[model samples]
Every structure is written in C-alpha cells, then in structure tokens.
Target: MTYSGDVTSGGAPAVRELDRLTITKVSVGPMDNNAYLLRCRDTGEQVLIDAANEAPRLVELVGDGGLAAVVTTHRHMDHWVALEEVVVKTGARPLVHADDADGLPIDAETLTDGDTVAVGGCSLEVIHLKGHTPGSIALLYRDPAGTPHLFTGDSLFPGGVGNTDQDPERFGQLIDDVEHKLFDRLPDETWFYPGHGKDSTLGAERPSVPQWRARGW
Candidate 1:
C-alpha cells in the first residue's frame, strides 16, 4: 500500500518506500508516540526511531534482522519507555542528544547538532531544536531519488512547534531554530514525520509559520 502517514495507537503502521530505504511508521504507547522502523534495502540493516512502548511489539517489528540502533529524539519519557527492553532484546545502540542523555534509562551515544547517524549506508542529519527540551533533535534523511524525509520528535508538528511549557523564551528559541534550521534550509516538499500523530510536508505547514510565531505555541 501507498504511504499515508496516518496511524492510530494499536493500529497498523504506514509504510513509505524510497529507492534505497523503506520507512515503516507505527504508533505506540498511551501518548500515541510514533516509532519509525527504517530498513536499508542494500544491506538489510534496520534502525528504529523510538522504542516508545510495547517492547514485545517493537521487538517483533524488529524481527531477526536485528536493530542497529534505537534513537530517542529527546529526553521525554513517553518517547523512550521501551528503550531498555528493546535494547535488551535487540542490543541496538542507544542514541540521544547530549543534554537529554541523563534522563534516559541507559547510557546513550551523545549526539551534537550536526552529527550524522547512519542506517546502513543512509546518513541521517541531526538537527538540534532546543526549547521543548534541552536536547530535542530531529533526523533528516534526504532520499537520493526524491525529496527529504524528516522525523521531528515533538519539535515541528503538523500545526505548530512542540510544547515549550508556555515559556516565552523557550518558545522563541524553539520557533527560531525550527524556522532557521528547518524551514529556512529545507524545501517545502520535505515530508516530515512527527513524534506523535500523522505526517505532513513542509509545503503544507510553511504558510502557517507566521501564525505559529504570533501565537507562540
């Protein structure tokens, strides 16, 4: 089936295929966190975006091919509830931003703003969008044959930026980084997957940048 990017908690995943990689998005946990399973066609190597919840299910999704790493987008507990179990089951490396590493249940490979995380031969550019958390990061995978795909963990969503606890400074920082690092650099056609709920393209959310800024959400 074609990739729709719409998934429900406990429902089926939405799969999108590119020339070199395949992305499978599944919604898990009570918060309805979205975990992405990326497979490299050339190497059969896989990496999971977040082990949010349902360890058994996530391990099942991983299967015997083994997981290279489990990337926790931020320090949010809702995003890494199953990280320990999933890692125990698959021995996948844990990767997270430096600021949020202490919040995780286990030690993680600290990532900097411009660090690159690879899934087989595919390289994911890490964009650090601070404010929602001190260590929030998004993964950018530019398809060789098509537009870019972004996995934004609670940073840039369909409607607005991530929650900043109603703090004006935090909100300002997040919006600015998101606009500069993401909107300003990436094209409108870039397809983005959020930490929760459905997916959308930069084109679909670009016009609302001013409104999101004005409202400070």
Candidate 2:
C-alpha cells in the first residue's frame, strides 16, 4: 500500500514482512524501483521478485537460507540488474517467460502460460500479460485464507496501466489479457500487487478498463 516508512540509513528501502513473504522496497539506481522478496511461511523458502537495481540490499535481505526462486516480471535492466547477486546468494532457480529469457546472468526456468510453481502451501499461476515487455508475466497465488493474489509486474497498476511505448500491439494484447483472462475470469475480490505504488483489489481497478481500451486497445 502506502510506503509509510523512510529508507534505512544504509540507503536501502524499508522492508515489510507479510506473513511468509518479506517485501523489501529497495531504493536502487536513479529510479528507486521496488524489489520484492517472497519467502515461504512453512519451509522458509524465499523467492525474490524484481530486484531492480539494488543488488547489495537484495543480498542483505536474503541472507543465507533456502532462496527458492528468483521470478522476474520482465527482462528490464531495472528488474534484473541485481539478479546475479541474488542467484549467487540464494541458489534459487530463476523464472521467466520463454520470449524474454536471456542474459539473465543466472540459470533460469523459462515458463509459459498456465504453468504453475509451488511456493510453500500455495501455487503460483503464471499468466502472460504482454505490454511493458514482450514476455511480461503476472504470478497468481491464493493465500491460506483463499484470497487470490496477483503479482502483476509492470503490466497492470492500481489506477493506471504500464507504459506501452515500445509496441502498441503488445500493449493492446496486455489489455485484452487483463480484461478477458483476469478481470472477466477471476473474482472481483482478487488482490493486486503491482510493480510500483499501493496495492488494490480487482474491484477497485476494474473501472479503469474503459480507459485502457479507449487509449490503446
């Protein structure tokens, strides 16, 4: 949600622990993009999503442990720059889509649509949301309470959508995927965690559909 706390004295963004997942908002490079750490509650397995540019901070947060996987939403430098350090420290498998899987600096498991990866008691459903990047993906997982959670990298934001300057067709496809695959199929109560900004429920952002369609689709 709101980034309430200030950055730590060490130039690292604040870290928030959510149940099993420990989300560290690493302030890296000039952009200060957000990086996430997802750890399993039961097995203590950790997964880092989008390290952005904060390699050192990401390493610090993921001290020696079961670093299960490194899942990147896309191949942007901001998202994967720190991935090399993460791979060395965690020894976790790197996950990404087949289209944009290259120069990862680490070995990765290329994933396709409908593929599932288990993190603790939950399973992450990989959904292709192409817009920000050709192989951009959103990871879906249901919490123990049965609440569906979507980790939409840079595809879908709270009140807005990701930038689509590169390819209009890909961007249009992303909008279509969200409309038909996500909003139209999933329940309105699904919780969304984007690549930046506050978290929101599907119902809260559903109204933005018309806006997306009018502008690009």
Candidate topping TM-score: 1
**Highest-lDDT candidate:** 1
lDDT of 2 by residue, 1-217 (tens): 5544344334646555555554455445656566667667677677777877767667777777667788888887777887887777667788889877874666688999899877765578899887778888898876655567788888888776788884678777878888887899788888777776656789988988898788773
In model 2, pairs of residues that clash are 52-78
Q: Clash totals for all models, in order?
A: 0, 1
Give the C-alpha miss distance for residue 115 in model 1, angstroms.
Answer: 0.6
**CA displacement after TM-score superposition, residue 216 of candidate 2 (Å):** 1.9
- Candidate 1, superposed: residue stretches over 4 Å from native: none
Location of the lowest summed lDDT over 10 successive residues in candidate 1: 1-10
TM-score of each: 0.99, 0.85
- Report the C-alpha lDDT of model 1 over 45-162, residue by residue, as the tens digit: 9999989999999999989889999999999899999999999989899999999999999988999999999899898999999999999999999999999999999998999999
